[model samples]
Target: MLTPTVVSNSTVRRSSRTPAANARTSTRCSNCAMRHLCMPQGLTVDELPKLEALICNARSVRRGDFVYRAGDPFENLFVARSGSLKTVMAHRDGREQVTALRLAGDPLGLDGISTGMHTASAVALEDSSVCIIPYPALKHMCRETGAMQDRLHRLMSEQIIRESSQMMVLGSLSADERVAAFLLDVSERNGQRGYSHAEFNLRMTREDMGSYLGMTLETVSRTLSRFQKRGLIDAQGKLIRIIDLESLRRL
Candidate 1:
């Protein structure tokens, strides 16, 4: 069982109880803003109640705190209800490598399903909240509803695709190409979630981005500067704007 922490104001405390245990109300899947991203598209009237009951808890994590650490026993999966987080794995030498960035509507802990233990730690990039979906209850619901089972399979497929893309980026791309690809990828993802794709704040620090892209911090900074100088992008601190989308796509 994973023990998730919740933040109230600036105070951090651990909790073993479900998130709904101390709450007045929980968001129902049918009415949630992120429903389109995580919920099954076609559900019968009978299935909606089961889906809502499956996600009875919601956790609030402060910035810099972990949602779940690597190696923790996996009891539930999570959906990012708001804000963002990064999943990282620790090396034998004690260095942590950033593996994936999770935005609002993204699923976390899918990597744990096979091993029954989390493979990476998920830390909040900013103050974030996640809707907790207990896997045992979810599996029971899946057995009862084919739509729910299909949704779970789709989430797993998406995780695999993201990992494959990262491998390709790290293995074949030059530093410049890698950075461009990263920016483009972020842009597309933001657009998918109904945010401004051309301009958005990149919450990840340059150092963290470097770790995820398999580049040095200096290399990441230098490449961004080069992109800005070439009029391909306008970057101010962590805010990035794609100035020439066509030109960036070609790179």
Candidate 2:
């Protein structure tokens, strides 16, 4: 029912992952730019190398690649190193809904922890890479290390908070307001990653955005067009420039 936990923009995100999963050493947690957004956020210098060793390696994903499908065994926790991902929940009738749009540094595959089976599937939105954190190792680290344990708890709390916020966006906001909210969400996420707050490209498609916002594709396009005409935003295809951040926020 909720869109997802936005991982947002990442720094040092491109540097990060793997050896045990047949992945080579691409980057380590101690040196990753996106470490702030993932498990390495609170670990001390001495603790970083220990955490890094828990990851066997990184994996490469092309656009449209499935990171994991629903019902897959929950084994590893994935962190996006580059590019973006979307977590989707499919229905019985072959329809699916976008549950989350994951940016660089977002952790994927955590939902499987409760049942030991993935509740949703993840797909890469672009040419991307992910650090595959071995679950057993991660759990061991959590038990033995206070920093890892605290970060794990914090990440879980973050997931709850984001879902709650998305519920509010869906429950009370008007169509225009919803679109405004969506834009603001993306902008804020980008800013958090140290990217330009006022300008960025949208990775999700119009249909995807509509699905996430619970609006029609036409409504999503129309609302964006209206925003452009009103000087609230300037859009050329997927690239967007927020011209009136205050007004958008006020909505």
Candidate 3:
């Protein structure tokens, strides 16, 4: 069984120290901010020293960078520190689908755990930084640390559950329900990151949102317009402000 650890927000903040300083001080390890979400929930003082040494090399990627392309060899686990990313799948016919949109604190590339190769391409939707935890180093830590292994299992399980739920939502929900549920879901997730749940931005485009929601672009635009007219939401291009969260939930 995996034990859940509660990492303090402060500890997470401390992980984002610059690489230069992180190389010198085990106590002041870098990548804390990004690791907050992906790392074990709570870490003891003893564990921190070992973890800092294992996670020595780190890099930053800007918007539009391809973290990894589909079919690429996978060697590291990626954690989004800030901004958003989209995993896309392109067919031989030139059709493209936006499979997933990940925000700050979300982990990507775990879906390739079994295959050892990425199934979709991960690209930053905005200026972003990601912490790359090499698989060998991570595996070594997990083998030596019970808590670290537990955290890895929990993360993998969570990913499975989320993907399963998304499939169910796509299969069973009506168009209106899907759109409404998507808005509510995004709002709640954003809220977790300390942003206003009712008033925040939509980083993905309408077409991409429609693709994820299993609706056409026209339907997405029309539905959004209806929400605006009904005062359910206020959206201007990518900026969406949820005016009536309750009503959105009820829908």
Pick the winner on TM-score between candidates 2 and 3: 2
How does model 3 score by TM-score?
A: 0.84
The sequence of per-residue lDDT tens digits that candidate 3 reaches over residues 15-64 is 55756545543322444554556667567888977876665333445666
Error of 1 at 10 (Å): 20
Report the C-alpha lDDT of model 1 over 45-104, residue by residue, as the tens digit. 988987887674567778887878887778778899989899999999999999999999
Of the candidates shown, which would achieve the greatest TM-score relative to the real structure? 1
The top-ranked prediction according to lDDT is: 1
Off by over 4 Å in 2: 1-23
- Please list the C-alpha lDDT of all candidates, in the order they appear: 0.85, 0.80, 0.75
TM-score of each: 0.92, 0.89, 0.84
Model 3 residue runs over 4 Å out of place are: 1-36, 56-58
Off by over 4 Å in 1: 1-22
Q: What RMSD, rounded to one decimal, does every model reach?
A: 4.1, 6.1, 8.2
| TM-score winner, 1 or 2 | 1
User: Scored by Cα lDDT, where does model 2 land?
Assistant: 0.80
**Candidate 3 whole-model C-alpha lDDT, 0 to 1:** 0.75
Q: Report how far residue 107 has shifted in candidate 3, in Å.
A: 0.9
